[model samples]
Target: MSSNRLKILHWSDYACPFCVIGDKRLNEVLEECNIKDRVDFEMKAYQLDKDAPKKPHLKMEEVFAKKFGISIEGARDRVDRIAGIGRNEGLDIKFATVQFTNTFDAHRLTKYIASQGKDVEKFIDLTFKAYFSDNLNIADRNLLIDIAEKAGIDKKDASKILKGKEFSDEVRKDEEEASDKGIRSIPHYIVNGKYVISSSEKSEMKFVLEQVLKDEAEGKLNINE
Candidate 1:
């Protein structure tokens, strides 16, 4: 429970399919090592589709098609493949029904939740399920508040955070830091502020956790490296 244990800065976007899968696998590794008690898990902000419009809400399939210059059907197939990967990680992904909303507000809410020192893993899970599985409009204030409340956060606090522009600067700062670090994708985990692991591979995730834990045990964590 010491503050000196390994700190993991996890950068992710809720809309990204790989992030959800990677998070689940990382949670499994943390559970196995009982590192939750010894490590600080911080969720960093990243926006995959920063210029996405707000109105005339775009379905994920169409969004993919436009982004990749593919047909809608092709996008559907690609999303199905991604959803299959999610299924392997035990996620109930309904890509067809997913609405692509700007996650700037959601990222702000996440930063606010982190400020309270609550379990951000649960918050991220709820947000992912709300958007990808439940097909809820995460950008909507009421929906965001409801999701936050369900994650054990106070409804009043959630309402206040969602209503105003609170934590917006903090979220933007995290996003800038991610850009400076050249993290171009989601599910990026930086351990001890040194080890960087991208992608959602279970084996790679486990290896990162083990390495961090070994460093903690041996007192040889090179933060500058």
Candidate 2:
């Protein structure tokens, strides 16, 4: 049978703690709405820092301080606030100690996972945990292969894909699409390709998603428009 499941395109990067928290909140709200099974989600690659080092260059606190021109102490305060949100969601995310490395390869891996007709949700969550909670170098091929293995991807296939340049174009394509849409932030979401739910509106996510689902069921969304 054919189903018109609510299609959600999410743009985010593993480097982002907000993406981690926002994703958790979204899922919780979806479950509350009882529409999780009726939704199809696709996570799009959106690099928070394309120029971030392939190796761990700086701790997230250092990056935070530099970006906002604040002291290390102040940076700790800011990132800790975000981390608290994750804790509330039962995610062990420590943003201050996050391994700030390039996430391009991680994004590529997600594209590869999707190509196999698999749901990338669990895989993406693991990547975030690896980068944030475990403080692992997501750019390291070896670490990524292990993460892939845990996500049910064959180790040999993961190694081959990471070793070569597989899914590079798809990663870049997602970035280009975000640019075309004038997106200037991580954790951007497009529902049914018409309704946009950015991080700023997270507090009302349940109500917003409920409306979207109701509209979708009523054939009111005309998503093609």
Candidate 3:
């Protein structure tokens, strides 16, 4: 059966804790509205730290401190605050253990997984867990393959993609599109290609979706005007 549904495009990065929370909150709203299948959701790649080293250049706490010009103890407190927020969302984030590295490969892997028609949302969720909870290095090809396999992607195909440049263009395309959209931060969401929500607030996400869904049903939503 053919139907009209709101299409939601999401841009996020694996290293972004806020993106994780934002995605989770969006899912919560979708479930609450009983519209999970009514919304066409696509996850796009966004690298929070494109210039980050392939290996951990410094501890995540130290990186935070240096970037924000704060003390190491202050960085730890900031991380703990985010982790506490994640815990409220049922995610246990081990920010202290996270190996801060470039997430380009991780984004490429997600593109490849989507190409295979697998559960990209599940794959993305697992990728966030792999980094924030398990503290796995998302830049590692072997780790990506293992994570993909766990997400039900074929091991052989995952291995091939990880070993080569497959889906690299798709990753770049997502990043370029994000740039064009003026997305300066992670967890940016565009609903029905019109409505833009740039926060991780569950209530705000719920309100946006509810309004969009109503407007969509009434034939009143138009983005091309």
What would the TM-scores of all predictions be? Answer: 0.89, 0.92, 0.92
- Which ranges of candidate 2 are over 4 A from the true structure? 1-3, 223-225
Model 3, 1-225: lDDT tens per residue? 125576888998899999988888888888888878777778898888789988876888898998999999999899889889998988888887799999988888888878778888788888888899888888888888888888898889888887899888898899999889899987899987888888899878988877877886777887443
Model 3, TM vs. native: 0.92
Rank by TM-score, highest first.
Answer: 2, 3, 1
Q: Please provide, for model 2 over 94-172, each residue's C-alpha lDDT reduced to its tens digit, 9 standing for 90 to 100.
A: 7877778999989898998888866567788788888888888899989888888877889898899999998999999
lDDT of each: 0.82, 0.84, 0.85
lDDT of 1 at 201: 89
After superposition, the stretches of candidate 3 with alpha carbons farther than 4 Å from their true spots are 1-3, 222-225
Model 2 — which ten-residue stretch has the worst lDDT? 199-208
Query: Which sections of candidate 1 miss by over 4 Å?
Result: 1-4, 32-36, 222-225
Which wins on TM-score, candidate 1 or candidate 3?
Answer: 3
Query: RMSD of each candidate?
Result: 2.6, 2.2, 2.3
Query: For residues 108-201, what per-residue lDDT tens digits would candidate 1 score against the true structure?
Result: 9889888887776788888998888998777787888887887778999998888888999998898899889988888899887788788788
lDDT of 2: 0.84
Ten-residue stretch with the least lDDT total in model 1: 49-58
Top candidate, metric lDDT: 3
